[model samples]
Target: MPTVLVTGASRGLGREFVRQYAAAGWQVIACARNPDTMGDLASDSTVLQKLDLLDPATITALANALVDRPIDILLNNAGTMGSQSFAKHGLNVQRFGQSDYADWEHLFQVNVLGPMRMAEAFVEHVAASKRKVIVTLTSMVGSMATNAAGGLYAYRSSKAAANAIMKSMSIDLAARGIIATPIHPGWAKTEMGGPNAPLNPVDAVAGVRRVIDGLTPEKAGRFWQFDGTEMPW
Candidate 1:
């Protein structure tokens, strides 16, 4: 069976990805901050591993434990919108002065640095697989050309940095035959997207899976939408 390693599998789109991949007969290595909290992922076929993005030891440990295993895909889905202050339900697009510096630091650490570290740790595992792919969950707001509304300073900036990181990784890891790209899952209904989001987690996950399944080396480093459209960087 093809093996996939997914982060942030405790809930939301990550959870949906785990469920779908496992049900389809894929060997899933699901990582969450608290593995015990993910009772829904308790399947005989899925291996739930505890992963704290803020902790490097855990990341290194997971990589070492799976050193001999080939991972077809590594989904860097673990991230935060920022501290739940003014942007809990939806993003708070206030004036530039309303920026939270502390939240910005935290967001960058989680959304940008964490995935880069993940890629570093598991690049070999993905390279050894039959289908070598590394996918990072980015956002449309990360696109500078698409910044029409202007706001979400912390969240937007971090995602943009993440996009840049993945772009660099795509080129650097190409010799290893690994495809790396950033993807936007659309305005899905989740804790971050709020209740009235246009897309649901199931549909968004399905669409993203379709996009991932169709990825080619030529498409590496490009920003993509869940619907398979190429996004502007």
Candidate 2:
């Protein structure tokens, strides 16, 4: 069976990815910051491990634990919206010069640095597997060409950085036959995506899986929407 390792598998879109992949008979390596709350997901996977993106030790340990295992797909799915810092205001827009630097740093750590670390650590594992794909969940807000409104300073910039890193990885890992892409999961109705959002986790994940299924080495480094449309920058 093909194996997928998903980070942030405790709740929301990450949890749904675990459920759908495991249900489809994939050998899943489900990871979460805290695995204690992952009841059914733990029982359903080939392995359950603690993988906090903020914690470098955990990243190193998880890499060590899976060193012998070939992972077909490594999903860098964990992220922070940095909404707590902007909670009193909102994420859509912030006052000029009022953005919190700490929140920006935090978002970059999880959304950019963490996934880059994952790719660095797991490149060998993925290259040895059947599919050989690395996917990070990014956003359309990251697109420089599409930034017409331009208000979500921290969230948007972090995702943009993520896209750039994945693009570089696509080129760097090409010879090794590893395909990397940053995917936009749409405005899914998850914790970050509020209840009024159009898509649900199930549908969103299904679309993303289809996109993943269709990826070839030729398609590496592109930003893609969940519905299979190519996104800008």
Candidate 3:
């Protein structure tokens, strides 16, 4: 069985990815901050890795744990949107015009730095895999040129930063035969996307699967929507 490793697998899209990949006969490595909270995942013989994006030690430990194993796909899906403080939560906080940098720092750590660090730490392991793919979950809001509706502050900018970070990884890891792609799962109806969001997790996940299945190394580092549209940076 091909092995797939997903972060933040206790809920939302991460949970769906775990279920789908496992059902498809992949050896799933499901990582979450609380493995105890992953009762459903634990029952499936999926490798439950406890990881907190806020903790560097935990990240390092996860890398060390998987060093010997080949991981077909590494989904850098764990992230945060912060509290709905409007300006305080987003652009303003990012520019140092805010009261609480707490959420801002947390968001950057999780949304921006976390994926880069994870990909860096696991590049060798993923290189050893059969499929040799590294996919990061980004957002349309991350597109500075396309973000028409404003106000998600930290979430928006951090995701954009993540896109840039992953771009560098794609460039550097290309010669190693790894294909790294940033995908916008679209307005997925997850907790972050809220209940009124347009796309269901299953449909969105399918779209992502389709993109991954059809993508080539030549397409690496591009921004793609769930439906396979090329998103502008």
The prediction achieving the highest TM-score against the true structure is: 1
What range of 10 consecutive residues in model 3 has the weakest lDDT sum? Answer: 85-94
Model 3 over residues 146-216: C-alpha lDDT tens digits? 86666566778888998898788789988989999899998777777777678999999989888888878
Task: Report the C-alpha lDDT of model 1 over 1-233, residue by residue, as the tens digit.
Answer: 99999999998899999999999999999999999988778788799998988898999999999997999999998888876533344555534887778878988889998999999999889999999999999999899999988878888888999999999999999999999999999988877787878999999999999999999999999999999999898
Q: How big is the positional error of residue 139 in model 2, measured in Å on the Cα after superposition? A: 0.3
lDDT of 2 by residue, 73-189 (tens): 999999888755332334555445768888789889999999999999888899889899999999988999998885888888899999999999999999999999999998888
The residue-level lDDT of candidate 3 at 166 comes to: 72
In candidate 1, where is summed lDDT lowest over 10 consecutive residues? 85-94
Report lDDT per candidate: 0.90, 0.88, 0.83
Residue pairs in candidate 3 whose N, alpha carbon or C atoms collide under 3 angstroms: 90-153, 90-154
CA error at residue 151 for candidate 1, angstroms: 1.0
Tell me the TM-score of model 3: 0.91
Off by over 4 Å in 3: 43-45, 85-100
Which candidate model has the greater TM-score, 1 or 2? 1
